[model samples]
Target chain A: MAFQIVINLIIACMWMFLNESYTFASFVAGYLWGILLLFLLNRFIPDTFYLRRVGKVIKLIFLFIRELVLSNIEIVKLVYKRQPQFEPGIFMLPLDLKSNWEITLLANLITLTPGTLSVAIAHDNSHIFIHAMHIDDIDESIRSIKDTFEKAIMEVTR
Target chain B: MIETGIDITLNISVSLFILIGTFFVLSSSLGIARFPDIYTRLHAATKASTLGISSMLIGTFLFLYAEHDIVSGKLLLAIVFILLTAPVSGHMISRAAHKSGVKPVTANRSDAYEDALQKHRKNS
Candidate 1:
């Protein structure tokens, strides 16, 4: 548990530094801010972590990159064609992972990919409603959102 | 002669990048205006702004380097940070917009997720 706390604090600092340029002094300020943000947000998120989970997190990132390239190609085709082929709709995704951080990460993945938007998470964290701009079948949309994205997230954060 | 030509090429590239950045910012704002709903607008805002900001940052960095002798390492830090942080912040914003009851443009079928969110409340 203590290990996870330290890891979480480190990640928070990493995100903070990702925006602000590095000076030793700025980093110290970021570290303190990260700690404060983490502590404040901790109430909503699960406060546990494991080493194995980190490996899955790495895998999920690779998956996201693969999806990103393919989706960009798909969007280009959609735009270039004379008629826009967007089969726009919303996907109501059921959540398997309950951690606030994990759910937020999942939302980030969806938004990072083109043609999809993370519209909302249910109050209970069991559902994440997403809007898809290029899907035809709602069931398939849900399946992809579930199997393609959420499943990866579930395995990693589990 | 080669060194001079290289410098000239770099100058052209930096100017081109700035022009492209301006285009991105224009299209994204256009998207925000033209798109019908919150979700579509979010896409326009995010995709366009990221591209714009990234290009603009790179352009500024190159300009600084070429004219001011700025080191590559420091400029690189700026580029990397923008690339990483923009998407994450964009994601967080879109999620907030979605949760605020902005319905999807479902011309025909019933949305399952909104229904599901309701169910999440019902079950618990």
Candidate 2:
């Protein structure tokens, strides 16, 4: 668990430091020290860590990227196909996986994708209602999201 | 002559920072517009805006550092405060929205989390 936490912290630092705008010696010093402490503690903690199915994650990411690119292209085409008829509405999608972090990631990913946005997560975490940009066939849209995107998330999180 | 190079570099960085900041702000707005609903919109706007404003503020600080002295440091301090608060506020807003019966995208199987919430509500 500590190792996982340390890795997460390192990831945060890496993300922050990538910009490298400021020249604060103290900031850099503090960052290094925090990382070192986390690393040392990580070695001692025995926490149940989810071993990501790497091959699955890679495959899913690839599939997601493909779909994302395709989704964007389709959205652009729809926009350009004059006389745009967007029959948009809210879709209530049932959540399969229950992990809070997993659900959060899934929702964020949906938001990032074109044409679909995760509007609200039911307080019960049972459903995630999304507002579709154009709901021509809500069922079809749900099927695509569930089969393609949400399933991939299951593979990663499970 | 010595100050000329510093001034030009500083000007360029300032413009770049401002441009990036503006882009982020726009992106956040776009996120709000294009995202599905309130919760999603909040997430998109908050994430993008934080990064965007921070970049702009950082750029501003750097430009100020190069151009002036001392006073600009105060500006950096203010930016730090904003960076600290924005995410927290966004989280609180989203959580409140969620608690007030905001519907999420419908899920597939049984939701244990929802059961817990329901039970808690009942007991209380």
Candidate 3:
């Protein structure tokens, strides 16, 4: 998956080089162009099913951005409150991620969001240890992570 | 005059981004100072800094791309690197912190590690 993304990047860069313009707009154009080309190539090629669903990837990023903004606001609000009312804890999140890469990506995504930091992974790799600052319900938190980030990752990396 | 008007608009938008970015950065610092524990502080520092710095970089990219008509590859790469690695660093820090026995300030309902340790002790 990483290799395919790198190839797409190279193709995007080559597109810009050919166009003689390195502006952001042209770079996006090139990236989309590369994606289209790769999609066509995948249709004809065997065992090259690495590249992702572009729309799903875009949706995942948008979801991440929304989470980022919303969590930032939540943290800001938490910080401004006169009384620090927090329910912070460390909990084990059981994983369904199959690969090391998928687990690492999920951990990173959890940490990158505000109010949640992934502390450790189990020695057996069955669960991830996470510290969340305002977890009203542990099940809900895990459900949201699984539904939003993990689901999107499964979609894109499939 | 028309050019000046465009410049003014660009300047205002650029300033807005910078200001908002700085505000988040400041909030993150405040969080670090005020939060109860190492893990929560790490959360604030990592997330806010990532978004804050990205916002500032976005402002810079927009200003340069709009005003000078050149998108800076270096700035773009910097933003990408920061976004990709911030979480990794946070993960490493928290992992190390936990391994080194940094306890949470007030955990309401969790002792999974302790339970695991007890189970291992009983089995052995």
Global Cα lDDT for candidate 2: 0.62
Q: Which stretches of model 2 miss by more than 4 angstroms?
A: A1-158, B107-113
Q: Higher-DockQ candidate among 2 and 3? A: 3
The window of 10 residues in a row where model 3 chain A has the poorest summed lDDT is: A43-52
Candidates 2 and 3, the one with greater TM-score: 3
Q: Could you report the DockQ of all the candidates, in the order they appear?
A: 0.30, 0.07, 0.59
Model 2 lDDT tens row, A1-158: 34665665575566457657545664566466665655566546465432335567888667744654454444444434446444455657888879887787677566545566565577778887665555566678778778877788887766
lDDT of 3: 0.81
Where does model 3 exceed 4 Å of error?
Answer: A1-52, B117-124
Ranked candidates (TM-score, high to low): 3, 1, 2
Write candidate 2's Cα lDDT for B1-124 as tens digits: 8689878888898899889777776766765666455654555554556556767888878876776664576667776666545544654565566568765433242223345467768988
lDDT of 1: 0.68
Q: Residue B33 in candidate 1 has what lDDT?
A: 70
Evaluate residue A50 in candidate 1 and report its C-alpha lDDT on the 0 to 100 scale: 45
Per-residue C-alpha lDDT of model 1 across residues A1-158, encoded as one tens digit per residue:
46555756686568556867656666677656755666566656665334456667788878876765555444444434565444566766777777888887777777767677776666667777667776566566566777878788778655
- C-alpha lDDT score of every prediction, in listed order: 0.68, 0.62, 0.81
lDDT by residue (B20-102, candidate 3, tens digit) is: 99999999999899988887788788888788998999899889987789979998899889888988888888778776877
Candidate 1 docking DockQ: 0.30
Worst 10 residues of 2 chain B by lDDT: B104-113
